[model samples]
Target: MATQSPFPFLDDLADRVGEALQPPPWFVHEAQRRIVLLVNHVLMQEPEAQSRLARHKGSVVEAHWRHFQVRVVATPAGLLDLADPAITPDLTLTMVEPSPLALARSALQGEKPQVRIAGDVQFAAEINWLVDHVRWDLEEDLARLMGDAPAHFLAQGARGMADALRRFAGAAPGRPPAPPSGTAR
Candidate 1:
């Protein structure tokens, strides 16, 4: 029932800053390139995901959020690469939540943000499958660098922190909900 954000001024300032501080075109382009590379690396670890993507080889998927857009095309190798700017995307997904804080709050509470989908339905289905089924094994990746025990310890700490954040965001993990801001006994 509370209609106010915990940090109202910061939230408003962030929204304004986000609107006014759009990154340069080259910076956005380079960020998109790195994102594609990371995505390909994750996809490479899952053969089933790769096979599903490979079935749609050359299909383009473009995602838009605010002023940022990333267009990637499925490659024959079952990986993704940045698509040419001119190639019309076979599928386009636009995130409906405009506020960064709102989106993060939804994510921390284990909810998916709303998306507006357009273009190929089958391609969208494949992408949805990828989202639901594929997960990066963070502990495994960390263990490769720092050995098993430390990696597991770090992962557990992270999970505990995430759970704390989820609780702070109004999730009930067998605990009472946090009191509303500006309220005290």
Candidate 2:
């Protein structure tokens, strides 16, 4: 017969704690992955236009397009032939002036949406860059938000940008601009 030490449980507990001390892989990527769905959900609901006063409305009904700029390159090669448009975001967050005390009270009450408190101040440029660069499966992207995906694929906005660019370039004042410098070949 063998006798075990009374300290055996302590050793098991220490080993379990050591394993738990190692960070979970999900913790590393959760925020990164969540951002895609979060941004998509927010932008999809953004309003086309808003009055200056609309910014002040705190109701869930409030929505506004955080403006995004994509550069236009005038060339004769047709709009589809254009390269990536330079993305510059110009979003100015204009929220309603709040009662400082009221805001403080709400803060204490934890009623404010986490998005606002999280400093998710809509960065239009980053979104545009992501939309342009990532060859997104739009269906998948949407589905991911709807909790339908096994994984997420980034969405591509370049197609839409190219469409818009083509319209702009066609109307630009120039002699078709010789198909841009590098693109001539």
lDDT of 1 at 164: 74
Per-residue alpha-carbon lDDT of model 2 for 62-126, expressed as tens digits? 11211211222212211111123233212322223223333333344334411211122343333
- Residue 44 shift from truth in candidate 1, angstroms: 1.1
Error of 1 at 17 (Å): 1.4
What's the number of clashes in each of the models? 0, 4
Q: What is the lDDT of residue 14 in candidate 1?
A: 82
Each candidate: what lDDT? 0.86, 0.35
Name model 1 segments beyond 4 Å from true. 1-11, 171-185
Distance (Å) between predicted and true CA of 95, model 1?
0.5
Error of 2 at 145 (Å): 9.2
